[model samples]
Target: MIVIDEIYISDEVVEEQFVCDLNKCKGGCCVDGDAGAPLTNEELNEVINGYEKIKHLITAEGRKIVETEGFYHYDQEFGWVTPTISNGMCAYGIVDEKGIVKCAFEQQYYAGELKWKKPISCHLYPIKISKSKNTEQQYVNYEPRDPMCNPGCVNGQKLKVPVYVFLKEAIIRKYGEDFYEVLSQIADQYYASKEAKK
Candidate 1:
């Protein structure tokens, strides 16, 4: 695992899968999401070519999602397209010259340029921020992650002081003390769980 701080979390699981194999896991994200990946303004510009292009592709609900979440996305409840398979392959994934399905973003990077920013929703994958159903404003604990794409992120490695230092300041600005405290506890728990993993 790529531990960012604190004592090392055993790297065995990740070394076997990720130390050198990360790029091979491309196309995993796009294999499913169809509505579109959440994107920031800059990333949107890169992908959709500014206002005119995006104006046509997004739905009305998409506008609301972007306004509140700073990301454009599809609700799973909205349902994915039928047949799941498109031309004997995943709908949104990109095919290589040799016809392998791969991540659309990974393909973007494969070309001459790499678009550095992803939608905030895409950036915070595996680690989700949610509002409780009973009270949309209230925070819910972070959800358990889907292991497929999240396998090597050092979830249980304690954010070392330096790492926490950077994170805490940003969290405080976004949420204040209560949020920060809860988040710190959450981080600890997440790392502890990660450390316990086989």
Candidate 2:
């Protein structure tokens, strides 16, 4: 593990390569999960405030679920999470013409309709953040969803893109630019030392 500013980062975060292959995965991460995407307290407010603007972008079924059950709910294990449809798909997920699920807020944000760009948890996918129960130290772990993420993993290896590099924007958004810069530097040194040893 690499410890930076008290955040414990797993080795796989720097060593593994990953870039989303949307065409193949078809956004299965949004649909196959047992619970909806986790949301921070601030993000929960954003969803509540922005729901009206993005409601039209959501599917009828999703809108109905949100209307009846509310935008989000507390999960026993995941804390606060977006509501899911009866099929277990995120209530904010919409199907595109290609049958790919997309975030309603993201679609509206890209179209200049909303300022918020969906939940950070969704943005930083394949990398999950958890706190150590005893110490409360945050851990950054690389955990790509299996089968759904196979194509992305294969694509990343072929392109030689490291997981950190692929998630540059997200890391910066979550931890700040300085954190990303330090991570990049550490990753470089780690790889260089590994190469020398080989």
Candidate 3:
């Protein structure tokens, strides 16, 4: 484990490889999950406030789910989460012509319609962050979602991209550039030490 401040990062985060293969996975991560995308308290407010701006991008069914169930709901396991449509796709999810699912919030974010891109949990996918009940420390674990993430794993292996490198933008966005720099340095040393042993 790599300890940085209050965060405890698992070795897999720096050792394992992953790069989302959207074409191969067809964005299954957005639709295959049993529950909707998890949201923080602040993110709930952001989704509520920004929904109107991105509503046009959502499908009619998605809008209906959101309009009837509200922007989010409480989950026993995931706490606050976005509501899923009848088809199990997130209410904020949009399907492109290619049948690939996408996040409406992300679409709006890139279009400059919203400042917040999407939920941080969604942004840092495959790397789940959970806090310890006994301590104030947060654990960051690399947990790829079974078959849904298989294509990404294969792609990452082919590209030789570590999970941390593949998720650099999200890491920097969540933990700042300084944290990412330190992580990169640590990862370099970790790999170098392994190479030396070999």
Q: Please give, for residues 1-198, the per-residue lDDT of candidate 1 as tens digits.
A: 223222222232222122111344444544445444444334544544332323333334433444455423334643212112333222224456654455443344455245433233443332233434454342212222345444333333432222333334433543467755654565566667878994
lDDT of prediction 2: 0.92
For all predicted structures, in order, the TM-scores are 0.36, 0.96, 0.96
lDDT of 3 by residue, 12-119 (tens): 999998999999898888888869999998888899899999999998999988998799999988899999888888989999999999999999989989999998
lDDT of each: 0.38, 0.92, 0.92
Each model's backbone clash number: 3, 0, 0
Candidate 3: misplaced stretches above 4 Å?
A: none
Tens digit per residue, CA lDDT, model 2, 47-91: 998899889988799999899999999998988999998888899
Q: Against the hidden true structure, what lDDT does model 1 obtain?
A: 0.38
Provide the lowest-lDDT 10-residue window in model 2: 130-139
Tell me the lDDT of model 3 at 107. Answer: 95
Q: What is the TM-score of candidate 1?
A: 0.36
Of 1 and 3, which scores higher on TM-score?
A: 3
Error of 3 at 59 (Å): 1.5
